[model samples]
Target: MTREEIYSEVVQILADSFELDAASIKLDSTLYEDLDLDSIDAVDIFVQLRDLTGRRPDPEVAKQIRTVDELVTFVENEIAAAERGDPEPQPQMPPGAGT
Candidate 1:
C-alpha cells in the first residue's frame, strides 16, 4: 500500500482503538501525550495494525514514535519493506520519521 493509504489506515486504527475522534487525529498529534496511550493501548493498536495489515511495528520503536506522522511514516516504510520480501525487521527510524 502507499503512504496515503497507510496514513488513512493509521487514523482509523487509532480512532477505533483509542476511542478518539477520528477527525481530530492529525499528523503531529502525539500518540502518548495527545492521545493518552499507554503500553496496553500500544499493544492493542499494534495488534489491530497487524490484523489489518500483515506488517508488525516493533513495540520499542513504536514507543518513540510520538506523533501520528511518525507512526504513519514508519508503518508505510515497513509495509513497503515487507512487500519487497525483506525477512528481517528493519531498523527503527527516530521518532517523527524525518519530518
Candidate 2:
C-alpha cells in the first residue's frame, strides 16, 4: 500500500479503537503527547498494525516511533519489504513461554 493509504488506515484505527477525532490526528502528531496514548494504547496500535500489514514490527524500533508520520512510514516500509520477499524479524517470545 502507498504511504497515503497507510496513513489513512492508521488514522482510522486510532479513531475507531481509541475514539479519537480523526481530524485532530495529524502527520506530526506525537502518539503519546498529542494523542494522549499510554503504553497500552501503543500496544493496541501495534496489534492493529500487525493485522493490517501481516508483519509485526521490531519491538526495539517500535519504541522509537513517536509520530503519526513515523508509523505510516513504518507500515509502508513493512509492506514494501514483504512485497520484496524480505524476511521479517520474528517477534520475541514472551517471558515464560514453553515453561
Candidate 3:
C-alpha cells in the first residue's frame, strides 16, 4: 500500500478505535499531546496495527513514532524487514518444539 493509503487507514483506525475525530487526526498530529493517547490507547493502536499489517512494532519504535507519517514509515519498514528476514521472530523457542 502507498504511504497515503497507510496513513488513511491508520487515521481511520485511530478514529474508529479511540473515538477520535477524523478531522483531528492529522499526519503530523502528536499522538500524546494532540490526540491524548494514553498507555492503553497506545496498546490498542499497536494491536490494531498488528491485525492490519500482521506485524507488531517495537515499543521503542512506538515511542519514536510521534506522528501518522512516522507510523506509516515504521509499518512499511517492518513489513519490508519481515520480508527480508532481518528482525528476529517472536516467541523464541528451544530448537524444535513440535518435532
TM per candidate: 0.77, 0.87, 0.81
Clashing pairs in 3: none
Which candidate should be chosen as best, given TM-score against the real structure? 2
The 0-to-1 C-alpha lDDT of every candidate, in the order given, reads 0.78, 0.88, 0.78
For model 1, what is the error of residue 88's alpha carbon versus the real structure, in angstroms, after optimal superposition?
2.9
Per residue, candidate 1 scores C-alpha lDDT tens digits across 1-99 of: 778888899999888777899999988888888888887887777777775457756667777777889878778767776789766555578877774
Candidate 1 scores a C-alpha RMSD against the true structure in Å of 9.2
Off by over 4 Å in 2: 91-99
Query: How good is model 2 by TM-score?
Result: 0.87
Superposing every Cα of model 3 onto the true structure, what RMSD results? 2.3
Cα displacement (Å) at residue 43, model 2? 0.9
Weakest 10 consecutive residues of candidate 3 by summed lDDT: 84-93
Give the per-residue Cα lDDT of candidate 3 at 3: 75
Off by over 4 Å in 3: 92-99
1 or 2, which is superior by TM-score? 2
